[model samples]
Target: MSYTFAIIGRPNVGKSTLFNRLVGQKLALVDDTPGVTRDRREGEARLGDLRFTIIDTAGLDEGPKGSLTARMQQQTETAIELADALFFVIDARAGLTPNDRAFADFARRANKPVILLANKSEGKQGEIGAMESYALGLGDPVMISAEHGEGMGELYDAVRELLPEPPEEDEEPEALGELTDEEIAKRPIRVAIVGRPNAGKSTTINHLLGEERLLTSPEAGTTRDSIAVEVVYRGRRFKIFDTAGLRRRSRIEEKLEKLSVADALRAVRFAEVVVLMLDSQTKFEEQDLRIADLIEREGRALVIAVNKWDLVDRQPGQIGALRTEADHWLPQVKGVPIVAMSGLMGEGIERLMKAIEEAYAIWNRRIPTAALNRWFEQAVQTNPPPAVSGRRLKLNYITQTKARPPSFVVFCSRADAVPESYLRYLINSLRSGFDLPGTPVRITLREKANPFAHKRKRPS
Candidate 1:
């Protein structure tokens, strides 16, 4: 029921800057270099009291067929088609360029209301460029500075005139009632597949969707941005984010490539479950371990996908060796689910999907306070706390604070004195006792304050 707007413009026109300002977060990567944004990222934006979905698209340009730049432009065209309106942004300081004039015509051809945004309009030169934007044939330009957060009120007013009014409180609500738990679970799960370049990330996604929705090529780094698509499997829907393959930081030097890597990282942080795709031929590499470690640190449910299974020789201990390697290299996420499949041949996909479901359920699993304290008592009795400074560390109680990675807080006499080994022992016990394998379990220690310390003597 929300309105959607696509912020379109030529390269280096501050579309991303405006997107960050509206969303109140740096969800999209911004750089001084042109064409840093190569994919369309959607975020819920707010200005004053108006709230809507805003999409930041790659700068419009004409490129040859099948080239990287061409694919970027195709992404922009797709955004335009899906948008309810368009914010055709121009660099007011640079005045109007041939690219701006040409894309203005493109935006008009979409047959949607276009709001001309003259960004970087803080000085006399910017004002001159804003006046020049009137020549593009779009309506009056709204001069603003996307970087310094200037002229948002004018932007809000222009957008308000184009948007439909919200229904009154007395009016009937959409669909008549709140959704049940089962009905709500029917919503798609947000899953992000990420790994090193040419790891068959795209191929695996395509095979799962049963269509060629994503472009696949043998060339490394073929996917330059994170692309999202929805698919229904066995009555459970999934919203999959296909991200660009990441390389080691030393190898990534290009400005555009850096942005793509940052985009993929953002996808990982936003996703509920992240599937780290690995090439079976290459097996476990340093970067693969790093990616897995990142997912663990981010507290997202993880599933290890050993892609390109078709090419590997079927050895007697191949699967076992692969799993052992996964556990050895990525000990941070112990017992992580590992599924080997050939994306080209579409083998073991069902098993992979099942693993994804299991991980998600475990990620959301929460333990009751009574049950948690019971387990904590047994765990502490089995392995007593280590003595620090010859004084036994007193462990008082434990309780689960939240789920979705299963966070807990342990109140003790001295939180700082708890040994790292003892904490790991408790974490492992909790994982095993609660049936929470392959999910990040966060246990924070807090010192119990003396309840009587704040009391004042009565009329003493």
Candidate 2:
């Protein structure tokens, strides 16, 4: 297996610079602005002779709980568990700050092997800041200038020290051309792009694949068939389903259109990442949120893309205003990343791909039994399942039944009597507890038979 290394630090710390340097491509969106990256971005990276999977995370900052920054912190923490090692980063030019210390403390708690980096260590001005970083206490800081591509040799040495890549004999070779069946099954990631009729769903998929695999038309509901396309991204093979335009039953009066709507739903059921697109002129229409709600109900990962953004008039407050509006109205899908781009112009298309992969990771996530049970106990304490006929619905235990639209089964005493409202509550609790937002979660209740209440075994 290739060694996975995560880059983590506070905002504007040159983490994206280092990521670009290591990836040998501009995979991450880098700007002077802080927090341009709210979702975790991944790329296949190489440094000198070393090959590894690199994760670029949102910059951390200590603030009010549940802030976007705070949620990004949770994302990084999850990445740490998924990685073989870590590269904790700090801004040498800005010098060490309180937030950096807070993040450093969080990394220390994980007890994972870490290589601390003091970024922006090119000029003599950063020396003092580098000196101040010794206080991180995780170990010596590796000084390097990510922007100038200096100190890469030193970076390679540090990573090789802690977690060496698995030997060639053990390492799974990258598929030569098309993905082999083994490789496909090993990572069966499903991505579904859905939106109201004519939101550029087909256009976006074509942009991502750089091909006209799915039919594109100006007419609403032109794509009556849900089309599936396969593409390999950054060596990871993703099976994408471009769904038909979903509309209300009354609006979709035609028999064929109704079937297309059903096809869109079936596409959601098997998806790991569901991208919900909106036409910029009509962002977040009632139908848009309803589609998002459907994605959430299915437990598939979710991303919102405002298409045809180039045509919109520029305004300073537009981005922030839209994001705030989403947070205020779409609380159920907290931390969902919305990107403004033109599928026609290709502006910010790469960023959308990065966000899609991040959501997919969270969707296929399977928690350990111990942690899940702990969360389950807490949820039960918070709001016990509703009673049926004056007797409490006895939910004995719960376990994930599958992934790729995570489905779980909860063993209970009277499954048939379980109210849909109560089931929804449990599903919401699971979503919040597990850091899964904008994704659908499916929970099925099954009754646990009591042998004592049944008749004795009949004679053969």
**What do the candidate models score in CA lDDT, each in turn?**
0.88, 0.78
Candidate 1 CA-lDDT value: 0.88
Give the residue spans of candidate 1 off by over 4 A. Answer: 164-188, 202-233, 237-239, 242-244, 252-267, 315-317, 343-346, 368-402, 407-434, 442-460
TM-score of each: 0.79, 0.50
Which stretch of 10 consecutive residues in model 1 shows the poorest summed lDDT?
167-176
lDDT of 2 at 182: 60
lDDT of 2 by residue, 1-460 (tens): 6788888888889887898899896545566767655556577787766778888877776556755456666767777887777888898888989988888998888778889998888787687888898988988888899999877878878887865534343366676346764655567477888988998987887887895545466767656545566778777778777777888667877565666678788888877788888899998888888888877776667888899999899899898887887767676676688888999878978888888887776666787777877888788878887777889777788888776566788888888998888877887788778877656677888887787876787899
